[model samples]
Target: MTDYGHDLLFGTFTTPSAQGAQHVLDLAVTADRAGLDLVTFQDHPYQPAFLDTWTLLAYVAARTERIRVSGNVLSLPLRPPAVLARAAASLDVLSGGRFELGLGAGAFWDGVAAMGGRRLTPGQGVEALREAITIIRDVWDTEAVGGVRQDGRYYQVVGARRGPRPAHDIDIWVGSYRPRMLALTGAMADGWLPTIEYLPRGVASLPGLNARIDEAAEAAGRSPRDVRRLMNFMNVSFSPDDDGLLAGPPARWVEQLADLALTHGVTAFFIGGDDAGAIERYAAEVAPAVREIVSRERGHYGSMP
Candidate 1:
């Protein structure tokens, strides 16, 4: 068995509105009080119901002292690498090392194009994301490199410098839904946030996909074990009487989650919902049971020290 931190990588997401922001912050306080590990907010510039990820993370960071804050996955093409690098570093400094960065090349062509970002072909987007990660890491490096420039095919940075380098390395999670993106994440990221669920289709394809990732990492001279594997389940709930309920009761839902972890290799799960009552049910009933199960599975108990 692999040694791990708090196993139930539980977190929250918010719709981007004034009311949604307040609702999310309230959940942050609740998640913190309940001993959750991280809270994440998503980004969308064109949506009428969106809030700024960096600004909101900064606010959440200032308000909570113990819980970590993150973006579920920020759109990399939307900002210049230097600007994003500095913003992430500043947030990391303010949060005392509790900031995690999740990035993706981004979908929603209409939204990004509206803001002057050209659409990227799949290959171009992946290249851009790879370059973004490289630049961000160099900027966050406390030790200087021989050169301060990144000359990737899709992105370039010259004399790019910033920081008050993060107090600790910022954990970077890249969202990926395809083989190419998965291999890219394996080559460059700290974690893999798979878009697919842990169903039979995913299970059947795992070995081949993971082998490809292994090949890519080996080609890059990186160990496959260096990266963490994470999964996301949108709209999860527990139902004591009905497992069919997409949003069910607590005990039933927690059991499904435990099974997912034991049978599959799901180390982390990020859950999403639009209703307050659903989130409350998750935090109050489902979260505690899942945490207990994970602790027992690890042969350890109590909160992380």
Candidate 2:
């Protein structure tokens, strides 16, 4: 069985538009009211057209009662792990534990460099991310009264006071596509976040990719299931004749998402699109059907001798 025993989650990926911030904010509230599990926005700090993700996240948290808010994958290059830890924990506290942290090493290096952030090669980026993960987790340990300390090639913290813990354990989901990044996710992160767009080989490549993560997790002396597998689909269509991924109606989406859980062990799904109607359809229809299918499959698998 490909089931990994992780609870199912349904979320929407909404854009943070500078011109349409209110519209974007409304959609987040709508998703929350519709009973969606998460409301995430893309982070592009240097993009003039995008609203600041963190600010938007905070506003959405205040505007909505439930629904987790986050940067789809925060730009770690621009957001220092030390300060970011406090910000995240504060948001978690204010939002009543309704926040999850999704991170990316860095993208658009030229843009990042222009914004006074260091440019990093792929290898360096992985190392920096590993260090950032360690530092962030350490800073969140309110039980420990000591300051955070870490010396690394890419990132380091010395005698940095730790506290203001999150209301709940915030899962750090890393959006990775390369092998080194996947290994880091397995070793350190609570979840692995990737998109179908970045996966050139499609769903067929999931097994091999998962194997790499598993190997890394085992090597780190952690259970492979310690890390959740989360993926995003760029778009879904309601065309029954279309055999493309996430295409067709609610029934089709159910089958597709269920297959990911039952075959690929992916438990969290972030539906990509800004359309309020699509979000409603996903939350109102596809999510329930997928949950039911996975539940039945889990029951059958558990009953097996």
Which number leads on lDDT? 2
The best candidate by TM-score is 2
TM-score of 1: 0.85
lDDT of 2 at 103: 98
- Estimated TM-score per prediction? 0.85, 0.97
Query: Per-residue alpha-carbon lDDT of model 1 for 127-239, expressed as tens digits?
Result: 88888898888888758855458778878777865455886789788887677887898799887766445434754555566566667777778876656666666655554
What TM-score should be assigned to candidate 2?
Answer: 0.97
lDDT of 2 by residue, 172-246 (tens): 999998899999989998999998878979898899899899889989999888889998887766665757787
Pull out the clashing pairs in model 1.
16-51, 237-248, 238-248, 238-249, 239-248, 239-249
Show model 2 residue runs off by greater than 4 Å: 303-305
Per-residue error (Å), model 1, residue 286: 3.4
